[model samples]
Target: MRTHGWRGQPPSDADEARARILTATRTRLSEAGTTSTSEVAELIGVTRQTVYRYFPTTGDLLNAAAADAVIGLEAQLIKHVVEHLARTGGDAADAAVEIVAYVYEHLRDDPALNRLMAPGRISSTVAGLTTPSAIALGRDWLAHFPVDWEAVGLVGEAQAEFVEHLLRTLQSFVVDPGEPARSGAELRAYLQRWLAPALRR
Candidate 1:
């Protein structure tokens, strides 16, 4: 449940500078749609050359921001899921509910995520987290389950399909909160009813 941030190993001056640059980029993007390295440099009171030194181009800046944001999002998901599972006996269905609830909460409270999910604010960071790549990463994170999937007979293709469906459902709920078809607990119960049989395979 460890949450990783830009904080670690006593960031060096260069690291601090890079973080400042990234932070500036995020701010500019959040505030204004188009952001240039010059604008970011001006905001941070640094030379454009310094900005370019850290990020050679706008694409590089965008890519780095996306990567960092996705990493942080993944960490947040891991921490929330771990804490929820601990309280719910680490059942997969319970974990699914916790994950959906956590995502909903974060989407509501996190300014960055709110922006990402907001209409027309979709950026590379948004795409990176919502893409198939991110979904796979989430499933891979769950694959490190403490529960014995094999013991429950839910191994192989059944487990894979269940994970895919679980992730998709959570994602769909995130995008359409207003029309949420079911509560997380209800969804969990439904999953257990169908998924337990597959696991017993």
Candidate 2:
């Protein structure tokens, strides 16, 4: 791996260096509720210039770190959806409700995610959720849910469309929660009543 001139031994590869920076950023964010590129560089024992090469702006770095932090949450979400489907005997609509509710609650409760979604921090968060990458991530996430896409006659573009719709629903709820925010059973029931018919259709 090419060494970017370092004050000490550099990461073995570009991927490793990027990972280190993201990890440091997460650590700082967790401890201080925010992080800067310079802080991440210092934490990783690299210079700000090195960090900037990987993430041109602090927004870029925070977005990357937020994405990294969400990796585990995504796995947990997939697992929850799979288990919900199993329990529902492969009821796609019901599983969708459960999955949506889980995501809503998880985002509301997760400190790291909440921090990213806080007041002024929402622009980057919104960008991250609405971008093509977010759509691709949604596609990949839905594909892992063990749902019977073929049985539901939701294949190809239809499946992709469903994922995008679901992502948009979740994004809307997160960004501008409706009056009298729904929670627990109310949220699940609301989603089921509204979303189930769509899935069935």
Candidate 3:
């Protein structure tokens, strides 16, 4: 028989509570990195023990915070792409370019996110953000993308892989600014050149 491993499914109530607490904690951390447990508990309308029940340690809270931020970020990207596509005659390739440009323009100035994912104390966030929860967020985001993946010569899995790689590559740029510098427009151009061929499939 196969072992369950240590990955037992959480009860639904506990899972919902954990998700709520993590959501609050992420907002606190993104807005203010050195958040207190008391503050987060208060924000979530829960007692400290309730918070502890979900995340037993400050490190755990921080880990959840990172994952939460990634979810939020991906949601925003998906929203933008959806809106853009609707307004622009439903062109997926155009939406893709806009999405990449949006990331290039906004990612650098996002302070809380920068500290959370940068090569500093919170690089652990990267691992958390790349987890299944975060990956699902990305998949959901791209699923609504206005592109015809199959017509573009990419199957569903390959399309998701392409968007995932693009996001991760852009994340690296956000985390490591000194690696190279370019204007937002220039970076957008670069991504278009690199991604366009694969997108065309």
Q: Pick the candidate with the highest lDDT.
A: 2
- Model 3: lDDT equals 0.64
Q: Residue 20 lDDT in model 2?
A: 79
The candidate maximizing TM-score is: 2
Runs with alpha carbons beyond 4 Å of true place in candidate 2: 1-10, 45-50, 70-73, 87-90, 105-137
Candidate number with the higher lDDT (2 or 3): 2
- Evaluated at residue 129, the lDDT of candidate 2 is 72
Instruction: Determine which window of 10 residues in candidate 1 has minimal summed lDDT.
Output: 1-10
| Model 2, span 1-201: residue lDDT tens | 446555477888889888878878878877887778888887877778889888999988887876776886898988888887877685778877777678778777654577678788777776677677777887788778777777887788787787777877788888877788876888887887888888787
Worst 10 residues of 2 by lDDT: 1-10
| Candidate 1's TM-score | 0.59
Tens-place lDDT per residue, model 3, 1-201, is: 111211243225766667767766767866775577788877766567767766888767766665565566677777888887788675556666777677655545543354464556546654554566665665666667767667775566676676677667656665555446877677767767875556654
Ranking by lDDT: 2, 3, 1
Indicate the residue-level lDDT of 136 in model 1: 64
lDDT of model 2 at residue 93? 81
lDDT of each: 0.62, 0.78, 0.64
State how far residue 2 of model 1 sits from its true place (Å): 34
